[model samples]
Target chain A: MTVIKPKIAVYKFTSCDGCQLAFLNLGNDLLKLTDAVDIIHFAELGMVNPNAKVDIAFIEGSIATPHDLERIKNIRAKAKFLITIGACATAGGIQALRNFADTAEWVAAIYPKPETISYLATSTPISTHVTVDLELWGCPVNGEQILTAIKTLLLKVKPAIKRDSVCLECKRSGNVCVMVTKNIPCMGPVTQTGCGALCPSVGRDCYGCYGPSENPNTDSLSKQFQQQGCSRETIQRRFLFINNQAPAFLKAGMKK
Target chain B: MSMKMEFNNQEYYFLPHVKINALLDYLHHQGFSCIGPQIKQDAIVYEELHDSEQLPWGLRDYQMPGQYRLEENNVKRAFSWANGPQAIKPQLFKPKESLWRVARDSHGKLTFKNVTHEMKPIALFGVRSCDVAGMLIQDKAFLTEPFVDKHYQARRENVFVIAVNCGYSSNNCFCVSTNTGPQVKAGYDIALTEIDDGFVVTVGSAAGEALINKISLKHATDEMQQAMQREINNAATMQSKAMPFDNTRVVRDLLMNNLDHPQWDDVAARCLSCGNCTSVCPTCFCSSETETPALDRIESEHSREWDSCFTEGHSYIHGKVIRDDTKSRYKQWLTHKLATWWDQFDTSGCVGCGRCVTWCPVGIDITAEVAAIAKPAVDDSASE
Candidate 1:
């Protein structure tokens, strides 16, 4: 009798590569994970099998270059279930700050030869280019969440990831509301909860490492920051940081 | 021990503020976890109290829309303010609980086993009238005839409530309008009204009478009861906010009829669709279940977690999200909270504790939204 294993692939584009590292960082689970699924393509793991058909594909990063646009389409077409991991793939990561700026002018200023650099105008999410079956949010996607996503996918069930804001986790963990108590400008209310509410627990404000939480009220949070005496630059930078390209945060940051 | 104590005639009792620890001790002796309001995380939240010293004695909360702060004052009363962000919902309906488990037996056959918890009787101290009302609403939800949640029933069965009648209203509180608070008429073991020196305690249930007998409570005079009533009446009448219009029909009718109203869009523009309002709402019982399968696929566990309607996926069916836009989702939430809930539950879901108003990052007041919908009549009649 022949045994068949589900093929898995991990791909990256224009991200910091932190999200891909999370899978390897699974440590003891890495061996068990490899046993569970055939990792056909994982560049970070030194296995590079591109253009090969896979059962599941974990896509990291956003579409920043013209090549990325084409590559992502190929990935989407080949993979049965294309799961987007990390804020870059889900909502366009930090480099998405360039979405607000002129890419041509940016290239002109940064490069010695102006016309040599080739890139898209806006750093857009993977979903902007192709259908994403599941999205694991966070600057570096949570390892547990990634595992849950995989397990759910194996069962042909929709992943049970919380779309609630960081405030829920913060409250559950009994962390004081930094924005409320200290009058600090925290994005916990608008930001997603996948990061385990790291920032606010340690006495700092959430910088929205995960993209917008479900129904993110960016306007209200922005107004709160303003009331907390945050400068226009501060408010702008707060929304435009990790997940700037997120539609909700982008509008709030750009509002005034 | 099984005999139900009879003391319905002795309704009012007194507990000197200093000796309130006796009540906590008595509950502890009965193998009950005493849950009460304590100052933590910048605001007062219900926490397990091993001793009465853990209570937020001298603290008071300054609550407003989008704002909450715990300030230390000279007020010697233990339970001064109405209530905090958390209600009895988390207690009865756990935020996250393992319902059951599934595993493969030695014969390689899948076996399902229900998760059973040895739940201790929980004595909730300092619960407000509005929250008790919220619990009653939840009781209708989890304990209803069609499908009763066994998990909720098991936990709720042994719970005891020590309610606190509001001596002063919080800035956003309007339990007066809802007719659920300021003075608790039902749904408590013992209702305490804080006065000059101590609390005027009133028994509600048989368990309350038994507990009263256990603690050395003094006989309450008619004068003391009158004073407590005056204090409660003052708190009710002095409430700064209430429903701008009657919640019975007009507000519900307006919201239901004005599904396409411009006010929804206006509110949606400001609304982040953040599920904070629903999460903090005591009566919002929306939940989602998930299955966690093991690596071997032989074992799996099912769990239920709190879910909110604000999420696009909450309305997702097949391959499409029903309420795609924020405006429609917000309208759906508002309509359900005020109107549709009445039709479904045979009562209004809101208890008017003002947690939604205070906790909303944007401060989207439900009352204000209703007022905007029921504009002309509300404006004319609203005297507060």
Candidate 2:
């Protein structure tokens, strides 16, 4: 007799909804994933069963609300393994921009009456509240990554994908160095690699979609950019974006 | 892996009588789909051959530091432009199209349909060298990737490439620096160079051999070959004016080290956040899938489409976009493509294709930006 596929669930908090959709990008693989795992919950596709127990949960988005705090706890309680997908679930996400500024003033600027609104002061990743067994990073997670994550989960094996930056992928594609060939400012060196180095391939630089991976040496990259003629101010502001709150980029951004 | 076949040099003939229409007929008859350049309202596009009559002949396109426009030039041999207004990427790897969809049936069962179309053998005419290089670059991005884009894989599998050796190079072209253009290279099935009275055709693949056998080719003399070579030489010599920078190992040392530099503010101030540069590029493959809510929540389906990091929603978590600040967004984009992408994929993100340079509404030249940042590295080891 064949072993029944494991049960899996997908969760979202605050994100571009890219990671959750990653399952959909698995056009052929979605069915295969469902066949391999009983999809217990997926809000975007209206596949939700809040009470159902799950073996693994793929969480996307950041936690910026009190409700999110409680929901993540519940997800963690039921899931044997929780995997975070996309930058939002790993970093504070773009919404985390509020971390550097005053929340009340920012809310008042947008809402007619800020006092009526209720929100967390800062956006944070799922790991901040729940223990994430694995983390898949990307601005909008790449489909191949989703595939790998699912396969690893089913087999109860650690995913073998690299946590290195996008620069490695660029070199593997045999492309002429964009920064060296054209002097373009790029983040491929420090940014994580899952997006297939898309931006650089199209004649543009990477925008840190995958966030920082492993022990990224952002300081060395920053100094190199300085030598490449980047002003101190330019470097600070750029470092403050996306994964700005990430320890290394945060340190660089906060420096005078 | 090197397959060689001797060209009977004598049977390789020129067909001066074959007008654009005849060539289209010939390509079509040989079970090949033709992709030619045509004027669509205001811009010249690489689309399925609308008609040979619409070729942008006798017109010169103007491409400056950050702009591209087609202008009327009295040169009658029209088809004189070195490159098309757009690259031939969307045909093979569509820019904004769905790859798959997730849906639920009346019985409340979920089903996924991998969105792929039948591949009609394509014959891309009026080909430019940089575009070919762009194709080669994209081949690595999509075809080389582990989860292959079955759609693109199908289209590229049966395509017959007919390369037109450039007699003229454009102001926006930097293919020469990438070691790619002006003269056709190995990827092409058949490469043609325009000669004075007739054309010189060089066949490289079995499909190209089959084509030469079918088309009534004329004897190619040494003089014809020499003339074609001189034409390609002239085109190569008259390349774009920008000097490509030396970025080897620059990613490991530069942008990764100095994240505190303030040059990003200047770039952010000029950025309109209009995602044009990324969309027109040949190798960007980042995508997002969206689910359209259905009449019955139980039967909703999901569809995947293109995505851009420049957008605020791209980095959203719970309720926030990670790189909400324009400066951070722009910085994330450029740095990731140039430096970090190499670390991830083991290759440079760019192929020296200057389409991003020409297409940028703000004319954000990446090559120039890297040069702007390439200062001597400060000894940060002591600071750390």
Candidate 3:
């Protein structure tokens, strides 16, 4: 007979909520996944806060508000294996753009009463506040990868995905490149490999929606972009867009 | 030697139509998963072939600056993959969609399962010389990375590569400059140089040599080898550099300084964060993951799929998008791949495949951009 299933929790902070939707996108795999674990808490599905102790926890989004700062620490303390999913949870997400600007001035311009709201000046990942066993990347985490990480969690093994650029996936799909024929700027050569060369297939450039890979060569690729007639602003804007919080993109984005 | 075989010097291996059909039967019986070119949705695509009829023989394809059209020609028994828009890495490396999840069910049971890698021996027929270089470059990303990808390693092992030397070069083909083309180098199990009447096939591996023996072919004379060399040399002579951007150091130094170069604002004006450039690049590999649920909702499954860098939500910090300005984000992508990647991986990330040139809507060519920045002195150097 199966013993008590391991308890699992899904948490979110600041994001487009696309990462949480990634869980809902599990489709047929959702039932199969549930058969393997116990879903103790998932606020998006109305699982509520103050979740119970469990074997694993999947946290989405980044820590932006003061309330999130305390909440992240508590979640880390309760879970035995904590994994961060999506760009927001792993690299601080697009919200990290705030790091390069005058936060007070931007806040004053937007909010009616800037003093009334209390939040962290910098939006950061769970690892920034505590420890993270695994990092599942992407702007909105891919559902299939999330499942792969969960299995690794139960088996007590390391993750299988590594730091390779999107170019690898582009080659694997046998799709003709959009950049070469169209003279377009594609991030496929430099961005990490998780998105299967999707944009190029449909005639679009990579905005770096996924974050950085391990040992990424941002400087070298940027040099190549310059060779392609890309202006300095064009190159910098690409980095500052989707994954400005990722150290690789952040360093380039905040270059000013 | 334990074995020796002889063949007639006068006879050629260009078998009759009937024998050619029979040869297909023999290859199929041996469990060869043949891959060749086929038209897909109007454009030609390379995929698996179930039989001999599926092979695009006697087909010469014409490519313009931004177009491709296939025409039947007698002199077309070579790898027409000759500077096509696509590169062949993902077939031997990464995939688009994958399942990786750990979650809990309403029944209070913990569950976790990942999609298992598959075993499929593939025969990459009619591969161009530059594609072999593309595969070698992929090794740097998937195999050489800190955590080796067992999936890629396994898939690569099952792949039997049959590379063909290109007879002609395209205007956009830059493999010669990249040291990746015209003739197949080491990575292949077999290499073929197409000549009149039949192909001059050379076996690079023992497996290829055994296949050569099986084909009942003759010993190639010294003249035949010279002709093969001549074919490759001709291809190289036809290719010339489109851009002369040799100074990579200046480009790297400029990016490293973080001096807020004014050139970036000009770039941003025409920039579209759609991600066409990165997707078609031979080396870019950034990605993101996500999860989708089952329709029943009894249990939710997690999946780690592909993501891109160009998306606004990608750089969210807590709840904020980090890259408010698109200009900086674009800069990070190009610099990392061309400049910093050398430091991280000990080699230039790009193989100069030239896919980024045609696939881009705005036609952003990396090689051209480097030449402009590497011009020695920046016009706005005094502003700093």
Candidate 4:
């Protein structure tokens, strides 16, 4: 009997390529993943097929350009399962800060010839352009999470991604609250728990790198930050940073 | 002379501040790991203690709503701080633990194996009265008839508690209102009240008496006893926060009657629903289970982790969430913790350690919330 491996592809759009590094960081586990699936296209790893029909497609980055808008739809059409990896593809990432700003003004300020730049007015998540089967949220999606998602998908099971706040993970790991102890303006209470409570564990405030958690009460957190002596601009900037385009964060960040 | 004297639970002795090392050393010699409070990550937390030197000596903690700061007072007293984020709950009811594993053989026979952890007997030193109360409440939940948690039982059975009477109380503390703290009442093998020079130790169990017999302790003089009582009384007076009503029945009735009270909406608006309150709550005992299947799909490990009502997953029923909004989730948590817990376990879930108030990032005080809801109704009725 012959066994046919699942064809897999990792695609990039407008990203920092940090999410792609998560796969490489898998190290020896990457070899195990390769044995389980056929890597038809992963341009960063030197396999260069832009258009390939695959069982699973891992998308990194956002749909920033007119070309990205069309490419995502094409990728969606080809992929049996479309999984958005990292903050960029899932929630429009740090680049989505452009969504809140004047794109024309910034382009004109940066470029000598502004008309040469061909980009959309707003940077949007992959889900904005195409139907996303699953979303793995993080600044750079955790390698273990990506591996687990793949393994579960291979077994025809849905991946169980936790949608709890970073505070939960922080508590479980026995880490003291940076916000409570040091009066630091941390986003752990409202941010998702994918980074294993990384920032707060290291005595730094979480900057919401994993996006807004389930039912994130950003208004309450913002009020808390304000009470902790954070300025209006600082509070806005905290919410509007990495996952600025996320609906809950966008609404909160835009608040006066 | 150090001799095995017939000591009862009521007997009090003085163990000098310098002789605390002897107590820790004795526990270690008895094949028990001594766990005590220490300064970790800017907060006082319970960690493994090898000697009395590991204790948070002279470190006074200032705890307010949404704030906790530790400062050196240059004193020599251990267990001077009120409490930390956790009690002894995590020691038995772990944050995350594997329950069991299942494997399938080549012949398709599935074998199930229980995943039992090898835990050493723990001597929990420097525990607080509220924490002791919290443990008893947890005992009612986990160790009661017909529904005994075997995992919790395994760890709890081999445990020894060395509780401490709170010499000082933080700003958020209201154990006096809850009638649970400032003085060690019960549920301890040995209870210690820290005086300026030494601890007025009261043995509460045979094991505690046996341990005390091994150490040379001076008979607690009336002066030392008076000093211990004075410190405990001072701790009670230090607390500004208090429950609106001391009666749990009245509090429970007020909450149950006012399920749709506007205060719920007001609190929900301010509450992040981050589960921080529940996480810091020593008596909150909700856990969720997950099945992790191997890549081969032949084996799986079942695990349970601490969960909170704040999450959408907690109220998840068939195909939909019961508590879909923050209002409903917050209502569920507060109601269950303060009101309905009595129905389930014949006691209030809160031990009034004020951990929830101090640890909440947004500083949502449970006592204040209860007061907000209850005080209005009482005022209106009184006016009538």
Q: Name the best candidate (by DockQ).
A: 4
Candidate 3, after superposition: displacement of residue B356 in Å?
A: 0.5
Candidate 3 off by > 4 Å: A1-256, B1-32, B58-74, B78-81, B103-109, B242-263, B295-300, B313-320, B323-325, B376-384
Report, in order, each candidate's fnat.
Answer: 0.50, 0.00, 0.10, 0.76
> Which CAPRI level is candidate 4?
medium
User: Which scores better on TM-score, 2 or 4?
Assistant: 4
Off by over 4 Å in 1: A43-53, A62-80, A98-133, A158-164, A167-182, A201-204, A214-224, B1-7, B103-111, B221-223, B376-384
Query: Which DockQ-derived CAPRI band holds candidate 1?
Result: acceptable
lDDT of 3 by residue, A84-123 (tens): 8898889888887887777778899999999998778888
DockQ of each: 0.48, 0.03, 0.07, 0.77
Interface RMSD (Å), each candidate?
Answer: 2.4, 14.6, 9.8, 1.1
What's the lDDT for residue B137 in model 2? 62
Better of 2 and 4 by lDDT: 4
As for lDDT, the candidate ahead, 1 or 4, is 4
C-alpha RMSD of candidate 4: 3.1
Ordered list by TM-score, greatest first? 4, 1, 3, 2
Candidate 1 clashing pairs, residues 3+ apart or interchain: A215-B272, A215-B273, A215-B274, A217-B272
- DockQ, candidate 2, comes to 0.03
Which window of ten consecutive residues has the lowest lDDT sum in model 3 chain B? Answer: B1-10
Task: Estimate candidate 3's alpha-carbon lDDT, on a 0 to 1 scale.
Answer: 0.65
Runs off by more than 4 Å, candidate 4: A112-116, B1-8, B377-384
